[model samples]
Target: MLLPLSMLIVAPVWADEHPGQAQLVQEVAKDTGKDPAALNALLDGAKKQQSILDAISRPAEAKPWSEYRPIFITPARIDEGIRFYRDHRALLEKIGAQYGVAPEYIVAILGVETFYGRNTGNYKVLDALVTLGLYYPPRATFFRGELKTLLELPDNMLAGPLDTLTGSYAGAQGWGQFMPDSIRDYGVDEDGDGRIDLQNSLPDIFASVANYFAKHGWVKGGPVAARAQPDAAAKPLTVKDSAPQWPVEQLEAWGYGPLQHLDPGALSSMQTFQGASGSEYWFTFQNFYVITRYNRSPMYAMAVHQLAQAIAEGVNSPESATQ
Candidate 1:
């Protein structure tokens, strides 16, 4: 029997280009309650995006702190943090109270993560997540989890079409570079408009950030970090746990004490930073570890802390907010 041309259906060339991705579509669809065909179609549309893999392999945080600090702790970023705090002062304060995180940490998270929403990246979040989810093996487990989170988002949770969604190469989205999973778990609709818009909602962004920190156990009144004058013969240390492995009194017995006054028994993680000046020994408190929970890097936490401090100084001085 001869069928009309309209009866013919063509298979998409992009479909099943990577067999594992097809399997992923099935798995994510099953887990997230999305239609398999719709999920497969979405996965098929995501380009390989080798650039994402490349970018992930060489994250700036991999650099020594000496080099990494300057990238984020610029004078301009401090000024921006001050200005950002000033602009969103009320919301930051309100959210800070609600979440028990300080306003400066929220501002610093935004300033460090996306320059206060000025550069949230141009790569499609869908592409970055899907590419890493399907192809990148080393971090595939983490990316796959984030992908599922994105898949499970209610239609109203998204800012726009998935294809148009864009963020960092690593698939971190919004003004705060939250991974997809964090978006769902910590995102807030501060405006009470009934939708969480991480892309355009500054109130939501600040709240989400504060919520993340609070959930991570950010100590409201605890010291974050302090400069330590370690004995010349003292060996460096690498952090292994969130709690301080070394107590302050013990470190002092070893000739390392806070240059600033603090409780002698305060538990802390010791880390060495390669500064432009020289190697500096430091003791990081519970709040510092809380910041590290955001990125799992000592360098990142220090940079954010240092930047926040600078911004705080600028805010108090009002003269250094010149930029």
Candidate 2:
């Protein structure tokens, strides 16, 4: 359920409360045709959340792959993803087919993002955006743009009343944890109910995720990532170079051969992780980069890939069939 809007900031505030707030109000009003008074009321109701600032300063993506992988790829998470897939199999499969994305990858996104919606977030969307947009100097310009976008977005694209909407510290909302721009660009109303309710509607949630991937060039039935057996003289790669720029043949010539049979001409890149056994290397493909578009971290994409693989395996196992 949505929490009540903070009453503390409900009192009317003028443009003088924060720097450039007046310009924001005027711009949003002109751009979106929203009532300036209502916009003021909404903006006044937003309280600065220091937690959001602190949270963004230390994102999970900052961690090494070994540490980051354990946070999302666990037995319980995989089990829950499998159950979610089974329960929503038909819809998942349909949406996956429509968008050319695999169902387990969709499920893995939900698992990693919000544990299948069990924890969409506790921060109010307004507070998260406002605090970061106005106070957080590092990315204030970006977050401010998001704050304006949130105000400008149509009601049909939102999950609920703007005052009560809750999401992550970074201002990402609903099941898929989309930011304001992502919602505007990629949100789907798969049920055709007029409103794109990412919170309660499974079709909207599933389809929105798939649509984002498809628009971002997720190849149908394409390989995501493959473990590579690096020869004694393999070239090293920093995490920064994870984009699929080189062909698999080029990587092979550098002593990084994929454990699986990937097309020699396929574009790929290498990512080295600090795993339990020591430094681990993997050849990442186009779909792997597509996953990174959701969260720009090689470790994040790897975790999703491994988790999706686990869930797909569980779905196909005889044990799952008996249940």
lDDT of 2 by residue, 51-119 (tens): 667779899988887788889989999999999999999999999999999999999999999999999
Model 1 segments more than 4 A misplaced: 1-13, 233-238, 318-323
Count the clashes in each prediction: 0, 0
**What digit string (tens of lDDT, one per residue) describes model 1 on residues 187-258?**
888878888888998888888898889888888878999988987776556567546777888788777868
lDDT of each: 0.81, 0.89
Q: Assess candidate 2 and give its lDDT.
A: 0.89
Question: Residue 103, candidate 1: how far off, in angstroms?
Answer: 0.7
Which pairs, if any, clash in model 2? none
